[model samples]
Target: MKIKKVKPYNQEEDKTKQLSRMFNTISSKYDQFNDIMSMGLARVWRKKAILSLKPYKHDTILDIAAGTADIGIKAFEYITPTQITGIDVSEKMLEIGKEKVAEAGLNDKISLKVEDVSKMNFADESFDAAITSFGIRNFDKLEESIREVHRVLKPKGKFVILEMSEPRMPIVKQGYLLYTHTLIPFAVKTFSNDPKAYKYLTKSMEAFPQGKEFIAILNQNGFNCLKYKTFFMGVCSLYVIEKYSS
Candidate 1:
């Protein structure tokens, strides 16, 4: 079966541009919204993902699609990397991220830039580790973006991703669908001016490949030692993989 492309805005603009505009519209309220919607479970998921990179220290880490820099800031808590570089298409998101970095007294360790993942600006093999949180589903060219991430990661570099997934348990699946299709959209409508953005988020999650299928995509993109774990009865997951050295 052919997969349909899931995009925000559903306009002529590409997914990247639409995502930027959508994120910028909610950048200021992003963190608060997350807390309310997830009931603080998102932080737990992020902490687990960051722990996967704890064994590496003094390495340069890339936080791709690092909206608001939450993942990057959390990275600092688990590992003392020499430098943390964050890139996102949303300039406003990066702006808020910069402020958070400085407020945390991590300005010296972290930097934020506006960059597209499908065509990243970093030189090949520039980063020792990379992490992205809930960001891959927004990529217009999923495989192509993974290839770019692989290109910049050093040999044996770790790439960890935290993203939403569907629950496998039958009852959980029903509840999950209800929360996403109705409750999430309603919450977005109440809390955010751009409810369509959250609606697109739910749609994108539904369209994205998960579990073993997603691992196959990573392997095909030159990632090795791929492993994944699910949380909240598979409502979310963490994929930990590495770049092939040889």
Candidate 2:
């Protein structure tokens, strides 16, 4: 299956470049906007994502698209990991993440960097576990990014992902469509200068392949033991997978 590209501003430029600019534009209010949009339930979603890690004392974790280090911070709190590295394409977002990391007094335990997932610099088997929350849909090349993630993880390394998904129940699906199409954009316009960014958010979430299709993609990219759980009647999905190495 071909991956559909969603540009932040509907610009003709590269999706990565557009996405970086979009995140930078909204980095300041990103957290607040998330709370408002999700009715403060996004935090619960992130907490669930972190719990899926099953971290060990010596675990070295890589948080892909680690916007503002929320997942990384939670990993430290829950897993008490030896070290956590978060990588994202948005420098401005990473800058905010650095401040949050310091404020949490976790600067010594966590590091955030500006790095593209599709072309990561990490060596093979660099991390014991990897995760991304609401980040996979923005990848310009989904398959390449997945392959890069597979390359950096150790044998049998765990991979956990949280992302928005279309609801399956008829009632929930109708409500979700109305929320994303009307309510979300209205909220974005009222609260943010980057309305296009949220527009892209809804568009991308709708276009993204979920459930079994997503599992198939992960299996094809060297990740195995794929499993997923749906939340809010499938409005969101949490995927737990592991790397397979010979």
Each model's lDDT: 0.88, 0.88
Clashing pairs in 2: none
User: Residue-wise lDDT of candidate 2 within 1-246, one digit each (tens)?
Assistant: 986776877558999999999999999999999888888888899889888876432379999999899999877776657899999999999999999999999988899989999999899989988999999989999999998999999888888889989998899899999998889888887888777888888899998999999999998998875568998889889998988874
Global Cα lDDT for candidate 1:
0.88
User: After aligning candidate 2 to the native by TM-score, how far in Å is the CA of 129 from where it should be?
Assistant: 0.2
Give the Å shift of residue 133 in candidate 2: 0.2
Global fold similarity of model 1 (TM-score): 0.96
**lDDT score of residue 2 within candidate 2:** 86
Name the weakest run of 10 consecutive residues (lDDT summed) in model 2.
Answer: 50-59
Cα deviation of 47, candidate 1, in Å: 0.6
Every model's TM-score: 0.96, 0.96
State which candidate has the highest TM-score: 2
